[model samples]
Target: MKNKEKIGFMCAYTPLALIDAAGYAPYRILPSEACEDRAGHLLHDNLCPNIKKILDRALAGDVPDLAGVVFVNSCDAMRRLADAWQHVRKDDRIIWIDLPSSIDAMAHAYVQGQVEQMGRTLLSWSGSPMDPMAVEKSITSFNRICAHLSELAPAFASGAIPGGYAAMQALYNKASTRDFTTTLEEIEPMPGKTPAPKHDAVPVYLFGNVLPDPKAFDMFESCGAMIADADFCTGSRLFSPVTGGQKDVYSRLTSHLMTKPQCARSFDPALPGEIAKTTLSRARAVNAAGVIGHVIKFCDPYLERLPGIREHFKKNNMPLLILEGDCTLRSMGQQRTRIEAFIEMLM
Candidate 1:
């Protein structure tokens, strides 16, 4: 590694937080606002939106400055992203973490194994031992971060902080904690600021995309709809409780990885049916009146399974609105109009 080169990892929210605590600048790569001219020649047209978006930004030099890249294989698109990057540019050192699909026994074991492997890799790259002090500090810092995020639920549920902006802020803080500690500290407050306005606000449960722009959720709020709950990778999955105190950092990290809610591609043999059921069940649990299905544009797994999800929501007498997103940007105006109309009809 170059003396001035900053080491960084690119993963979803959970690992991003953990890596941040480990003293590495981790960036969450979004998929929209892509620079087609730069990356168009490298990847195919049929690639997933998240992959396309990241590649586009990399080609355009929009990504954060870092010495290395860590790509987590949370989904197929991400795996292919690593492949495409390696083929196009072999100079950057890339580490790919093979994340499992669900929270099961097998997955848990796999996660534990992966954590050990990651520890070894970090040791080689950073030339620092994965000692007890570093591990404890990382766990403590992450716990503090999770506490801060939990405090934002009320603001997120309310109109104060747009979900997209809040989500992006979470990423920004995780990526640049060394640069923005005060901002994170400021946002960490109790959420009981006069329970989210119930003024004709339709309660909607968001599912699918992990971190969307706050503007999209703000659009829902404009229509008097409140996001009562979200099964997002960023919102819910990041708060994995530590197991058996600090000594078992390994188990805590692995267990959290295994149990978090996953995308449609992560569903088992049920072919979208299970995911729809899981989503609706979660929606009902949160007392949400309806569901908002946000799928990344050109994400084949999610795109091919929307119909089944719609039918499942219909059976629950719950209105489902599908919004097409590209991670980096939220430009679904037509869908926004439809969502407003649906909320109007439902309310």
Candidate 2:
């Protein structure tokens, strides 16, 4: 244990937990919290909003004790962002891991290789291999966390929990890297805040990248839309359970991440439909009216697949409103009006 140096880690969903397990304080790039506007000037509008926001954060130098930054090529935007990071953080070691976009055995093996490579990079940078015992413990902890989150999502949907309030708490859990057991102990059910069975709002399933502003959520709720479920990598998709109970913790960790629905960069041929089904099922289970998809500008993967997803929803007669923006509150006013109108039509 070499004094537990704090490393600034940024990547798509699955890799965050791994870096944390490797004894680094894994930092997910939350561009909404950034101090400066580096991304607003350089990157074109076609680049992924999340990437742009992250680049802006990097430029602001808000990450004070960052040892290095990790980049996972989970999507094309990330690949280019890694190049940008290389240019900006010339002094920091940039570990770029190529992530596969499927859940098959070959995809698992591909991700496993990436995990092993990340381990070597960590050893070279920190002069330490992730402790085998710690890796195992982390796996168990992550599994528990995933299970608890799964429970939370449904409970939040069923009026057993207040969804907005629970989201606020979960965001804290993610930012602090709290282990599952500790988080569970801290999140006691709100005594009087338990949701009453109310049916005034139209249930909605939301999809897309991390919204930099909380106002986007407020906008949706203002339109009488209750976000019953979501498939965004930063949202519910990021918390799916990692398959555990394996002898090789390293391989299992990679495999678990590769299989989970949380990885947005994954391009499995079946995944788009799988996600559609899952989102629809959850929505139907909760009696949702439609879906409000926030399509981040320049996110090629989500953009490319949007047409097909829209078609699928149409087949099921599930109305979907696709809003394009960079997830900044300032840039999203027009989108808010459109959503408000869409919700009005739904009524």
Candidate 3:
């Protein structure tokens, strides 16, 4: 098979199945520490560090060879990042996805329409038409990937997986960049036995917008906590399966996007407390001793929802620690003392 042109995308809302159907590689543009200074100079300092890091990568010419890129208007920072990319990387084909914040009938319709439009745009860019069969094939393949990761969730929660950071890195890395078949082949052979905790580790549920540094997971482990599970866009949130029973491809795709465990930016008006409920449910499922909200600095969506998340934990008498960092190890390092304290308190 000839190497497919990579289409870089930012948010989870970007439909990878559609990208695959359009004959492009759906490479997630992850955040990194490489070009923060340059990004800060280009964009404002108060913007979300996740977006800044991505901008830095693009501006520094660190991103892989790409035919195009996609940015979802999930938040103000992301919108600004798309704007900055237009100015800095004008040569790259950039596509903006107007993601809906609410999960209602209207929102679903809007998302379905957007997905259809994105399909057409991707087809135009990649010289591939919208093939329903290709989309279905992609969906089936991705669903298998989701299944493999879902199978490992219990292992991670039970402390069976050694090196939480490495495990998470492998999980996110494969899901973001690799094809579904490759991802499945890589994970299917892993052992699933529950291992005893290396320490009497305090199990904690970690949720956030982005975790750029996997070493941050190491920091948590060093602080005497086990990341029982995570709700990061880069983590378990990617493991959601497309809901079954949809007769058509578009509806199936829309169902998958809308029903997955949502980020703070994607609201469910029907269940205003859904995000908090989902977090609490996951924490309870893993017998987590506490909850950690790790978000990038100036992430408007996560920031807006933090109060409700805090209240949910407080009402349940659960220890909740909110750590805001700038998508860099140095920023994460500064919070080590606090993280240790929180772990100690949990113990």
Candidate 4:
């Protein structure tokens, strides 16, 4: 990927396969550091912490040089961030897509259109039209990476391999920033590092907007909580498996984006308790003893629906623990005692 220009993308719904086919490497901008007030002049201080950190990072020159940026209008915070990005980085192409919360046919078609437009822009950037087979090959390579994670999910939760959750988190972080083919090297355990004795840690399912720091997982493990499975921007939902059988590649790819383990932004009004239902399904799949719902501060979509989600979890007899923070390890570390008590009760 040395010859390929890198394009920065934020949301999971962005069509990374298309970016790969366009002869570019996809760079996912994850705000892993503490929120800074430096971006306050660029955007509001009350905005989502993830947004603030991402903008602040760009200003600090901590980000890679990219030919373009992809942003999803999944919520007001994200939309405003895209608008402010122009002020921060004046010379890069910024592509914004309107993500629909509905999962109907109309929504699918709308996503396909957005993806195709994104494809066109990417192809133009490369100065050549991408071959259909290249797109398929790119998707196949991405699915290979996802398959690796699917196999490791059990160890990640069971604590069968000590530090498995941290290892998995590192892989996901690398998968987003580097080439998929290059990421395969670090998938397996290193040659000399031996697996530590497995302990019976309290397995818990974590669902949130973004938990990018591997140290965050380390902190949980220290508190006797093994992240058996999670639904986060930097975790399971990152590179979703794109299902086959659709002749049109865009349709197949867009379907995966729209229907993968979703964030709180999108919903089907006709389906009552959708978020609760999905959360239960995911948590039960891993046989978690309890559920942990972590949301970044000021994230309106998740915050507004949290009350309903909590009530649903309670009704179903699931032990739920809610944590709110600024998307940093410092914030998570402060809640250590609370996390320990919750894990102890489950144990």
Using lDDT, give the best candidate's number.
4
TM-score-sorted candidate list, best first: 4, 3, 2, 1
- Where is model 4 poorest over a 10-residue stretch in terms of lDDT? 188-197
TM-score of each: 0.83, 0.84, 0.92, 0.94
Better candidate number, 3 or 4, judged by lDDT: 4
Tens digits of per-residue lDDT for model 3, 249-298 = 88788877888888888876788866777888889998899998898888
lDDT of 2 by residue, 107-200 (tens): 7777788787776677677666657676676666655655666556545544566555235435533644433445545443433344456656
How high is the CA lDDT of each candidate model?
A: 0.62, 0.66, 0.79, 0.82
Angstrom error of the Cα, residue 299, model 1: value is: 1.6
Q: TM-score of predicted model 2?
A: 0.84
- Model 1 residue runs over 4 Å out of place are 1-10, 32-37, 102-106, 160-184, 189-198, 234-247, 268-272, 328-330
Q: What's the CA error at residue 205 for candidate 2, in Å?
A: 0.7
lDDT of 2 at 158: 44
Question: Over 4 Å off in model 3, which ranges?
Answer: 156-159, 192-199, 270-274
Over 1-347, each residue of candidate 1 has an lDDT whose tens digit, in order, gives: 11223444444423443454445644455544646645546767666666777788777767656656777776666777788777755787776567766556777677778776776665567666667566666666656655566556655576555553345335433533231244345555434243554435777888876454555556666776777776665445545434444356677767655544566656665343787788889889878888887777777768888998888888879888888766643455557778888788778
Model 4, 75: alpha-carbon shift in Å? 0.8
**Backbone clashes (count) for model 1:** 4
